[model samples]
Target: MKINILIPVRALHDGKRRLSPALSATERRALTGWFFTRTVAVARSVLPASDIILVSAAPDLLAYGQEAGLHIVAEAHPGDLNTALRLGAAAARRKGADATLCLSCDLPFLERNDLEAMIATARPGAVTIAPDRSGIGTNAMLTAPIGAIPFLYGQNSFTAHSAAAKAAGLIQTTLRRRGFACDIDLPADLDSIGFMKNDRHIIAAE
Candidate 1:
């Protein structure tokens, strides 16, 4: 099946504000760049860059995505996360995608295998979700037929997505892997891992 990996990104300057308590503004921005770049790297390892789309309203991020040879979908300005993701899904559909995996960009510990597992979980009428460590947030999800259910991403989004998929009559699967569970949103999340960055990958050391 033709698949696309759509990653929604916020403006780097305003991306990791919740971590301000432990990281300076500059550090937070750098961290945001690091997280997004690493997430894309992992995706590239799973699929060709041509099939990966970076969805954002940020011009800077779009430029970066273009430089990385990834398809760029311009999200509506002042849009919410769900809206941007929906737009990305639509774009993927227009490109003839049979399934699209919506992935969050802050997954610091994410690996190529985590992405592979999510893709493997997808079926003709199935939705697979990888919940965050708290099991309240959706870190990664692959949906067959793109818009079978609304994009529900926010507080307690895992529950929202579960109900939506069930209502849509799609078989649901939840993947619980350490790589998918670890996203660097708060200071505590950042403190849980060690990051070593090089030209290619962000190696996370426990």
Candidate 2:
């Protein structure tokens, strides 16, 4: 099957606002850069043969996507994450994608094997959700047929997505892995990821 990896990123300034307590505005922006860079890097590493589409409201990310050789889909100026993701999925479907893997940008530790394994084990008519460290938030989602179900990402999103998948008559499977579960959200999350002290990509706010 032709798999398309869709990565959606908001503006650097607006991305990861929840991390403000642990990171300043400047730090947040830098973190956003690191996040996107690593995300694309991981995606490329894992799905090198698959089509990779990056959807973003930030024009700056367009160049980065281009440099990474990823297909860039500029999102509408003001739209939520789900909308941008939908746009990307539509584009992927139009491009003849048989499946779409929607991923979050904050996962820097994600590895190629995780993705390859997921795709290799995926079943049709099922939605694969990789939950975050807390096991409540979804970090990665695999939706077959692209428009099978609405992507709802927020607090307690795992349950919500599971319900949505069931409603769409798609089996919901939860897969957990360190690379897929650890995302930089709170200060504690960063610490857990071991990027709090010194990550080359990070720029302190003050």
Candidate 3:
């Protein structure tokens, strides 16, 4: 399958609000930037660079993504997360992508093999949803034919997406891979990243 990976990035300067208790605004931006850089690198390992699309409202990030040789989609301002992902999927389909996987930007532990395995589960007219550690939010989702079902990405999105897929009569799979499960959103998420807590070197990577 000609799959494209769509990564929706919030503006670097206004991300990770949940981490405010533990991280200063500047530190949150820095951490998000670091996460994006590594996420893109890991994505490239599983798919060709051309198959990765970055969707964001930040002009700076869009410019950087273009410069880095990844497809860039300009998300409309005031839109929700699902809207950005829908725009990204549309953009990918326009570029001849047979399927698209929407990935969150906070997965610090994502690896190539895990992503590859997730993509392998996707077939034409299928939907694959990966839940976050809480099992309520959706960490990653794949829809073939690019837009098989309406994007249901928000609170309790894992259940919403599954219901949508079932309603659409599309094949659905729920994958609970470790790398995809551990998206860093809260203070507890930071504590869960064992290696990052012990190794300042990795956390401070620029």
Candidate 4:
């Protein structure tokens, strides 16, 4: 099946507001760039046949996504992450993708193998989520049949996704992968991942 990955990014200035306390504005921008770069790299590595779509309101981010060899969907709406993702998913479906994976751009450690495993395990009328380090936040979600479930992302998103899946009568599965579990949101999270140095490549960034 052709899996299309949708990465929704808000403006660079407001991208990781939660992470601002841990990093300076410059550092946050760099971190955001690294995060987006790593996400695209992982997608490229994992699904060679799969297409990576980046939906963002930031012009720089769109350029970066293009540089990363990903399809860019410029967000007409500036601040709405959900809307951007929805548009991207719709575009993917229109492009004839068999499945769509909505992945958070902050997962620096995500591995190609884990994504492959998730794709292999995917089933019709099912939704899969990869919880964050706290096991409460959702870092990655896969919805078969494209728009099977409404993507509700935020704090406690894992539970919300599970609830949505149950309500929709879709089989729900949670896969705990180390790569997908670690996301950079706070200073402590950054330290915990030991990603303090500047790394251009995904493997080194992680």
Candidate 5:
């Protein structure tokens, strides 16, 4: 299917700021590194290393992706999340991608089977979203023929993405998945069982 996966991560120094009440800046930065590492591992488990792309302006993170044998799409600058995603998607399309999965870098519980399920059920010309636990934010999105709809990632982004897809005359579906829904952003997000096991969830057992 010439599938490509894009993961957009903010520079470590500027990430996880919302968790300031529970984590110091240094701690948050360290946790950002950990989250990125684990998210890359999960993505690798689902797709070939060459098909997984990390988009970021952070030199260290770009280096990490290169060292990990993943495709590195420079974000140019740490601009808005949606802009970074658009850049990544464009890069993927130029690389001959027929489908792209835009994934969140903080999905600590993401499992390969979750990706497999979404891929298996994805309909062409459709926008498939995996929403966060709160069902208000998007954790992952799959779109065929990349750039079918504008990327709207932010507060209440799940609704925005859905509306964009419908407006584009594309089928829109919300794919509920435990692993894909469990992104870590706040102190309360640490309560998932997968987090306790450090995300060693079943990858091949669907």
Candidate 6:
């Protein structure tokens, strides 16, 4: 079975707005870049470069993705995240993928093993949903047959995705693993990253 990883990224300039209380605009973008790079790195460890798709409305981000050897797909709908994800799903399907693991770019602690375990749970008619540490948000989701379920990706998406999968009669698996539970978001979330709160090393690539 061909499995692909799709990550949809917003423009870095406006990303991580919730952390603005503690970090500057430059810091936020740097953090965004760090996470984006980290996500791609973990994905590359499990799959070939061609199978990891990066979708973004920002041309510079797309260009950076292409430079990293990821399959770049331009998000046609600028501000609509679900539509952008759908476009990534379509791109994965076009590349002959049997399943698409939709990944969020802000997973600071994600490792290669996390991605490998997620792939192992993927089936032809089933989906795997991984919720955030808060259990109120979705961190990672793997949908079979490329886009078997509609992308409901905002505001309590963990429940929304499960409902969508149940409504479609597809088998659902909920994975609550430590590696998949954390994602960088609010100012408080930075404290758990295992380093100094203002450590600028994450954005050293800049």
The candidate scoring highest on lDDT is 6
TM-score for candidate 2, residues paired by index: 0.91
Predict model 6's lDDT versus the native. Answer: 0.87
lDDT of each: 0.86, 0.83, 0.86, 0.80, 0.83, 0.87
lDDT of 5 at 50: 90
Error of 1 at 144 (Å): 0.4
lDDT of 3 at 71: 92
- Give lDDT for model 4: 0.80
Select the stronger candidate by lDDT from 3 and 5: 3
Q: What's the number of clashes in each of the models?
A: 0, 0, 0, 0, 0, 0
What's the CA error at residue 12 for candidate 3, in Å?
A: 0.9
Off by over 4 Å in 1: 194-206
Off by over 4 Å in 3: 76-78, 195-199, 202-206
Q: Which candidate leads in TM-score?
A: 6
lDDT of 2 by residue, 58-78 (tens): 888888888778888997685
lDDT by residue (1-206, candidate 6, tens digit) is 99989899999897999999877787788889888888888999999999999999898989988998999998665767788888889999889899999998898889998988899998889999999998888889999977789999889999999999999889999988878998878878887766454466775433
Candidate 3 or 4, higher TM-score? Answer: 3
What are the runs in model 4 whose C-alpha is more than 4 Å off? 48-50, 197-206
Provide the clash count, candidate 4.
Answer: 0
Query: TM-score for all predictions?
Result: 0.92, 0.91, 0.93, 0.89, 0.89, 0.94
Rank order (by TM-score, best first): 6, 3, 1, 2, 5, 4
TM-score for predicted model 6 compared with the true structure: 0.94
The parts of candidate 6 lying over 4 Å away from their true place are 203-206
- lDDT score, candidate 6, position 73: 93
Which pairs clash in the backbone of model 2? none
The residue pairs found clashing in candidate 3 are none
Which residue pairs does candidate 5 place in steric collision?
none
- Estimate the Cα RMSD of every predicted model relative to the unseen true structure: 3.5, 2.0, 1.9, 3.0, 4.9, 1.8
